[model samples]
Structure formats: C-alpha cells, structure tokens
Target: MPIISLPVIWIILIDIIAWTFFHLLISVICLKLSSTFFLRESYWFKIFWWEKSGKLWQKLFRVKRWKGLILDGTIFLKKGYDKKGLHGTKISDLKTFAAETKRAELTHWLSILPAPLFFLWNPLWAGWAMILYALLFNLPIIVVQRYNRGRITTITSPNK
Candidate 1:
C-alpha cells in the first residue's frame, strides 16, 4: 500500500481548495472593511514597509514589466475597478486609490498567515507547498502595490 491512500489524497485536495477559498474570501472582506477603517498613513501599514522589499522586488523580479502585463491582462489596477467606478486622474483621487491599493496589499499578506498552520494537519511537503502557493499568488501583488503607491506619492507630494 502507498504511504497515503486515495481517500487521504482527496481529503488533502479538499482542504487545499477550502483553504484557498477562505483565504480569498477573508482577504476581500478585509479589503472592504479597510476602506472605511484604515487610512493611507495608518501605522499598521507603515510597520510592514521595508525600503528593501521594494528594491529587492524591482531588482529581482523586474516588477515594472510584470505590472504592465498584469494591468493589461487583468482588471487589477485598472480604471473603474474602484468601488465608485472612478479612475484616479486628479491628485486627491490618485492618493485615495493609492491608499486603497496599500490596504489590499496588506490584506493579501495577512491572508497568507494561516498557510503554515496547515502543517498541523498535513504532511510537511504538502504544508510547504500550500505556503509556497500563497506566497507566489500574493508577493507580486504586494510588490506592484508598493511600486504604484510610491509613484502616486511622488506625484502627489507638495514638493513635486
């Protein structure tokens, strides 16, 4: 007999699917709540900011090219995706949209937090695989959010 049975494999698959669904669902909920409760300058967001992450992402991933592809391929970061269905042309609107993007990026990071807990129920390889999946899905978005927010901030700054 194999180390893991077919029924066990089915259970693992179900768990992975459920985990992905809950992760996305909770992320959306948090994103919605954050729009009302959090500000662009919120301390929680500031704490996570690493000047190095942005540099690393740019150097390692060439996020600008990926961002362009993503923007073209998906509704993400596109105009009219906002709740008000407005695009950020004006400085104030751009600032608001930047803040919203930061909130969303933070939510994605938070959503990944539970991945390691899968180890409690799953084999080591399976648990790590889920964690990798979570990171792969969210890291690019996080990098893009930071990159765009930086540009928006620079544009909106009084000194600019």
Candidate 2:
C-alpha cells in the first residue's frame, strides 16, 4: 500500500474546509444585511423582488444553471436605471426625471460588493446563496403583488 503525500492531502482538506466556511460566512452576512437591515423596513423589498430574476428563469427553463443567471440578472436590473422615469421628448421632463429618480440608487451601492465578493470567492456557493436569498426575500413581494394586483397603480405620466 502506498501512502499519499501529506502536503497534497492537506491542500485538498484546506480547500474543502475553506470553501465550506466561505459559504457559511457569506450566507449569514448576506442574510443579516438583506433580511434584518435593508428589507426589514420595507416588506416590499423583503418579499417581492430582491433578485427575483433567478427564480423566474429557473421556472422558465428546466435547467439548473438558470437559477444563478436569474438572480444575477435581477440584481443587475435592480441596480440599473430607475423604472419610474418618463420618456418625454422635452428637455425639462428629462431633467425632472433625472433629478427625482424613484428607485433607490443607494441600494445598488449597498448590495454591490456582497454579490461580487461571494461570486469571486466561489460562483457555485454565491449562486446558491443568491437563490436562497431571493426566495426568502420574495415572500413579501408575493403578498404585495397579490394584494395590489387589480388596484389602480398611480402613474404620474409626464405631460409631453
């Protein structure tokens, strides 16, 4: 019987241990920040749409990879331009939209680092974390969407 090299075994062991710890630590931190801090104040955020794109895709395609792609996609969209702006041709309307964008820009800054950090460390774990986070977060959104489904959404359309 041949004995394995100590360094090789040690390296493999370290990789597994590090990977597990990284997953756990990142999950806990994101959960705390997302659930307790940011989403706590706004049930809409906690329950409905924080990273919903992943789940949507997962449902659309039977493929497992869609899970991460959906989550990452939603995060990217949420961090993108505010959806409340009007597409008026006039300069004044554009200026007004620019001045008072409804979507929170600060959320982008807050959620930015955690996703990328986790992703860089391990895409697999990060994707898992994102999926879990999105599901947990969507509980509130579902309620809101249902509650307000037929209700008239007030849209302050800019006068062209």
Candidate 3:
C-alpha cells in the first residue's frame, strides 16, 4: 500500500537519514526562536490534573534516576542553554531552565510530526513502527522537560 515501496535496505537507510535531517532541522529552527518565547507555559506545557504537579513522572518514570542519561541537545548545537542539569541556583537561572524545557519539549514534539510520511516508502507495519520510533525517541525527553519545569515552578513560587 505504500506509494513508493522501496526495498527494505533502502527504506531503512532513508528512515535513518530522514530522522536525522528532521531532528537537526527542527532543532536549528527552534534555536532561532527567542528563549523568551518559551517563558510562559503554553496550553500543552501545562501540568494536567493527573500529573500531580509532575510528581507522576517521578513515581512512574523515575525521571530523577535516569533523566541525566538523556543527551543534552546543546552538544548538537551550541546555541542554546545546556540542559545536562541545573547550572545555577538563582531564581533567574531557574526561570531560564524552565524556558529551555519548553523549547526542548516543542522541538521533540515537532520532530515527531513527519512519522506518517515514512509510509510513502515503507509498508503499513513499518510506518506504524516509525510512529512508535518517534514516540519512543521523544516522549521520555518530553516527560523530563515537563517534570523539571513543574519542579522549577514549585521552587520559584512564593507561597508553595
């Protein structure tokens, strides 16, 4: 049912190349945007009632135990804040980290948008595999971003 039905080897090569291209392109585009743009949590970044102010990730994903294992996007492009860990203790520093989390989350979310296009060359099952690949590659990072941002909010809030 694919539009092109490329051979399996070619399809695998193309999938690798395409994902690299899309991820880097999305990262570069996001880098060009002002960090200030991410300062405010948009609708998607808001902690859902079910998220329990992001503690859900700790309880379910044990984010603190392994989130540092995630690669820092700054290593790929030197233009943004380093997310390897908290770099400072000042309120301003925390705010900057929070903003960068939004940027990271948005980049990962955008990176997943092209999954369906793999169907042009891959079979039905492969295309769904691509979708799974996208989520598996990006969702944990997104979870870390949201979880860290929620923790940041707790620190920066006055009454909490």
Candidate 4:
C-alpha cells in the first residue's frame, strides 16, 4: 500500500478546513444581513429567511440562471396581479421587490469569497441556487398567495 505524501495531506487538510469555514461563514453572513432585505409588514414572513428545510432542495436542483428566473417571475406574476385589479405597487409589487432583492443579496454575499470557491461550484449555481431552492421549496406558499389574491379579485370585480 502506498502512503499519501506530506504535501498532499497538507493540501487536503487545508481544503477541508477552508471549505467548512467558507460554507459556515457565508451562512452566518447571510443570516445577519438578511434583515435589510425584506419588508417591515409582518414577523410571520421573516421565517422565510431562516428556514432550513429548503437547504437540501436548493443544493439538489438550483436554477442555472436564477436572476433571470427572478426577474421574469416577478414580471409575470405582477402582470397577473395587476390585471386582476390588485394594486401593482402595494401588494404584488412589494413582494416582487422583496424576492428579487433577497435573491440578489444572497448571490452577491456569496460572491464575496475568492475566485476558487466561485469557480469550483459554478458561478450560476452558486449565485442562484438559494433563490431557486427557495422557489421550489416555497411553491405551496406561492400558490396560496396567488389563489387568495385571485379570489379577492373575483369577489371584488363588478363584472361577476
């Protein structure tokens, strides 16, 4: 049996330590800085920031272009809300802003690390993985919002 070289062993140790530190460091930074990302409306919504169940989902199937997904989704959803008689800037608009802002903040925060980390994980994956994971994991909440808003529009519309 062949033994690993001293330099190779040192490199492995360094990589492991660095990787753990970087991962935890990013999570902490994101948590601390998240308050500035959302609205002041309610405490219930803040749970979205700290939820852990979505972590695995984000890691498994994060979108390659999350920024675009966010931008387009916000636009698409906002249009639906608008045509349904919802105030564009009050409800849907604010939600869109919060989602996009949070997405960008998380992506930018993760990008603060050195080049190796970004390249090693694929920049697209690293940047939008959280946002994608949030979408996938939060689909139920999204659907509820859409359904509730749609119902409100229906009940309030005069044409009905």
- TM-score of each model, paired residue for residue: 0.72, 0.27, 0.93, 0.31
The local lDDT score (0 to 100) that residue 159 gets in candidate 1 is 58
Q: Flag regions of model 2 displaced more than 4 Å.
A: 1-6, 34-60, 63-160
lDDT of 4 at 68: 26
- Local accuracy of candidate 3 as per-residue lDDT tens digits, 28-125: 99999987688875787776768877899999999999998999899878778898878799998998988899999999999999999998999999
Error of 3 at 65 (Å): 1.7
Cα deviation at 60, candidate 3, in Å, is 1.3
Work out candidate 2's RMSD over C-alphas: 14.6
Q: RMSDs, each prediction?
A: 4.9, 14.6, 1.4, 15.1
Instruction: Write down the worst ten-residue block by lDDT for model 4.
Output: 76-85
Give per-residue lDDT, candidate 3, residue 27. Answer: 95
CA lDDT scores, all candidates in order: 0.63, 0.35, 0.89, 0.39
Pairs with backbone N, CA or C atoms under 3 Å apart (clashes), candidate 2: 47-138, 47-140, 47-141, 48-141, 53-70, 54-70, 54-71
lDDT of 2 by residue, 37-134 (tens): 32222343322343342343234443343222223212433433232325574654443333222123223223333433333333465445654554
Worst 10 residues of 1 by lDDT: 72-81
Tens digits of per-residue lDDT, candidate 4, 64-100, equal 2241233322342232112222345555554554443
Mark the regions of model 3 whose C-alpha exceeds 4 Å error after superposition.
Answer: none
Best by lDDT: 3
